[model samples]
Target: MSNTIDREKRLHNRTSFLSNIARQLGRTQPLTQVERPALRHTCQNEVMATFSQDQLKDELVRYTETSLGAKAVVTTKADLEATLKQLCLDYCKDQQGNAAAGETIVSATAALLEMVSPQSLETDEHKVHVWDAAAGFDANIKIAERAKVGIVLAEEALAESGTMVLYSQANQGRAVSLLPEASIFVVAKSNLKPRLTQATALLHQKASQGERIPSCVNFISGPSSTADIELIKVVGVHGPVFATYVVIDDM
Candidate 1:
């Protein structure tokens, strides 16, 4: 059949390409595998490796506020809903200081909704929408574009760079964080890691185990910013102008 001939031709081409590469490398054939060499330095993993969970949480807050120019708060699980509501209210206000004048979009993840239901925040002036999988892409994108604030639960928090890691899912679309004017990342204290090294190691482990990784993994470090325009630093150039981290303690 024509399909069978095409498949064989493609495979032959790929093998020929690899053979040429092998010849350039002074090998008769392509290598099946290569062993990893041990490095003389492991400082990347060693930094803050000994810090307790609480200590890491403190470092996360400190780095986020001082270096990243973002807001962060550590609160107990009992006060999480109230803390989130207050923060949302502060960010969703209009120019005239009308409370809840702007709309908000929240990821429909169980970890997030369980902490604070969107229904509790809904009002006549303020509309809170969840990432609705049933509504499909066009509907969700419209809601995210109009929302003033987008909120999602972070899978892990990196202490060194004040970064929040988000593993995209069906109910947690990438637009929920990218399209809004502001982003709220809620992370549990227990999930705070020391740095990006651990986060990458996690992915490596998953790959080794033949587990499917997320289609999109976002490492958001504070608000969107760039300094490329004439070397003058400008904030909120590409994405949300503001970012806030809400760390839930006693989780």
Candidate 2:
């Protein structure tokens, strides 16, 4: 009888606690959420200073070849998709990782494609990797044995130092960049700006609204680099040795 009574009391309290949830949330109905609107500003400075075909290729090359020492190529949507497919085929040829390389590439790249756009990349491949890219942590572990290049969709940038700020969340994983030999940034032009000062203020504005910042706030200017010994260059010590920024211009 004592145990029975105690169980009933615990059940009652659980129900009562659940009943108070709506009041705590100030909701008589389901909570509706809204996205923050995008802010737009023009490039007041010289476009050439920031935008140049030569610099674009050079920057990617510097990070890919020297820093990360990656032999990555920049191409159109079609080219990237095809390249990924070819990579999978190569991996599949010898049953690498017991997976078709095409599937591994497709599995990881698919999630990225969906985040960037649905109609953008061809998705009907219907192939899935043994791992999922959205599972950033798990994916990093699985890809641990091989060279990996992570691409983060940055929310903002500071032109003063050519620094890019990537917010870590469900889509942006800590290991996605940290575990890879080379990490790339797909900077949405919509997030680009001319100054870090302005970006810091925006951060404060969000904080004022009681929004907690992400777990990891990264501001990267270049690859994982160090100059400790005789000021000589050593890269990819802690993280990716090479870094690339593929700036997607906003209209």
Candidate 3:
């Protein structure tokens, strides 16, 4: 009874004192951090449900219809190996100054060597790879020697629509996303999810556990493209003319 009364009075007194100080200071934030329990309360945000496969497909389709071109799904290791070879022979052959897509992956660089030009683009031992999804990709790929295209890994790519998600990190530099004209991505079957909302939620969950989200969170649909010039649809004016997404099954 009395205790409750005292607590109420104390809170009231505190509020009054702070309010007075605030008035005197004329916006007291620049000098000292003021008390605002109300502001802190707003920090708690509502977590939304992530997208399902169907939703992801829709997003992909929207992107493809506008820019991103054809996509392929690879289920086995053999498929990956074959695709790597195909990209080297096909994408690099005729392209002299063309910038293709960057290949994206979590790890494993067995076929990466083949994708990079066989020319002496490497100084010391670093091979000149046009685009590398693996972290710390410093080697310059000799596109001039073969073909110029970039490949990046999709954190999550929607199957129905063909959209790719690129979560930038220190290892995965911003250059991989920007410098290349074309982009190639490898989305493993294991990581494929349904929606963008869900994927953002997953990223949020990681951030909550004291993890830092990459500097860039890109949702690329297809090639470097722009319809901004005089409202005419121009491809490769802004980015690659062709961006391919290869869906692979985990082994």
In candidate 2, what are the lDDT values of residues 1-251, reduced to their tens digit?
Answer: 55545555645566557558977988666544456676586453343356544454445445445544344344454354454443333333442444222222212343356544322322344233333445656554656425344455567755445566877665455565566555556554455555566667678676656556676678877677778999987877787766655554421
Each candidate's number of clashing pairs is 0, 6, 35
Model 2 TM = 0.52
> What tens digits encode model 3's per-residue C-alpha lDDT throughout 30-98?
345445356545222322125554444444545555545554545455566556545533444434745
Best by TM-score: 1
- Top of the candidates by lDDT: 1
The 10 consecutive residues of candidate 1 with the worst lDDT sum are: 3-12
lDDT of each: 0.89, 0.52, 0.52
Q: Rank the candidates by lDDT, best first.
A: 1, 2, 3
224: Cα error in model 1, Å? 0.6
- TM-scores vs. true structure, each candidate: 0.86, 0.52, 0.56
Ranking by TM-score: 1, 3, 2
